[model samples]
Target: MLLAPENTRFSFALLWTLATFSGFLLSLLFIEIGEKPDIGVLEATVGGFAIALLQGCLLKQPIFCIRWILSSLLGWSIITAIGIGALGWIVPSTEFLPLRILYGAIYGGLGGLGIGLTQWLAISQPMAVVWRWIFVSSASWAIAIPFGSVVGIILRRLTHLFLGEVMGLAITWLVVGILTGINAHKLRS
Candidate 1:
């Protein structure tokens, strides 16, 4: 099993796929629970960036702009699919979906740096010792995702505690962190 360290277009493409799929899944999660405006791009932004930066900092990979664009669009596709498909569950709000999508891109683009920063803070070192990055990132994600989601929903006075943003990203970290561990073990082997 050769889990190639992300280095080039191919790796970023894979990252885009994973991020998009995860975003779609997260959006589906909302649809299942009767959400209409539920977005997915935010999740992919955070998750893709999370994994991208992880691979970049740990493996010294390079991710370009195209990857981000594709990832964001893919994530938004899920939102569109659910918003259009699930009519019964979706409540048409005054908030413009198109505007939200645009806002998601803008925010995701800017906030995407959180991913790189998280990776840099936690996974910059290349040592054979047991690292504490996973725990640190996990803790931070927990606080950040839930806090943002809860506060945003509350401020808007919404009912659902949906955190399609950084939550999936934390899950991605769990999986990719395992990948990183495997890569380390393989190196040792």
Candidate 2:
């Protein structure tokens, strides 16, 4: 079945969401629940590569795809490393809901900034069209992480599910994908 032009945006959102969630899942293989710098690096590198590769597939330009993946890898790795160093690995606890949410937002926002800036370098578009992506990326991640944290915490507490944080991570990526996908379509145009 063929998709209409307008449907492309939705496709991008869906693909992005899936990609990010899958990336997070893949990261779990190597990541332990800890504050180690190596954990952060591994999480970012593995997750970022998966996310970028899948996202890049949506782009028409081959060179753009390559640049996107490379930039994303570099950006995610550096920012995650810095964030781990500064903030450590944050796990949501029921005791400090508000603080956890705040920390999640800060970490997500910083990560977005790093990824966006690096990706920005790869785009050939005019600054006006492309610049909004940085802010959009930041806002998307900021909102996503907190929302995910709340959901994850609730699920863990209520259901007694192991790895409830995985759900939270998926939700976080879903939000990021939807918001960023819309912006990405605009940037592409």
Using all chains and alpha carbons, the TM-scores for the candidates as numbered come to 0.26, 0.84
Q: Count clashing residue pairs in model 1.
A: 0
Per-candidate clashes come to 0, 0
Model 1: per-residue Cα lDDT over 69-157, one tens digit each: 34434433343443332211222232344544444333333333333233433332454332343333333333333333333334344
The total number of steric clashes, by the backbone 3 Å criterion, in model 2 comes to: 0
| Highest lDDT model number | 2
The prediction achieving the highest TM-score against the true structure is 2
lDDT of each: 0.36, 0.71
lDDT of 2 by residue, 37-76 (tens): 4356766676678778878877778998899889888887
Q: Clashes in model 2: which pairs?
A: none
Looking at model 2, report the run of 10 residues with the lowest lDDT sum.
Answer: 84-93
lDDT score, residue 8, model 2? 82
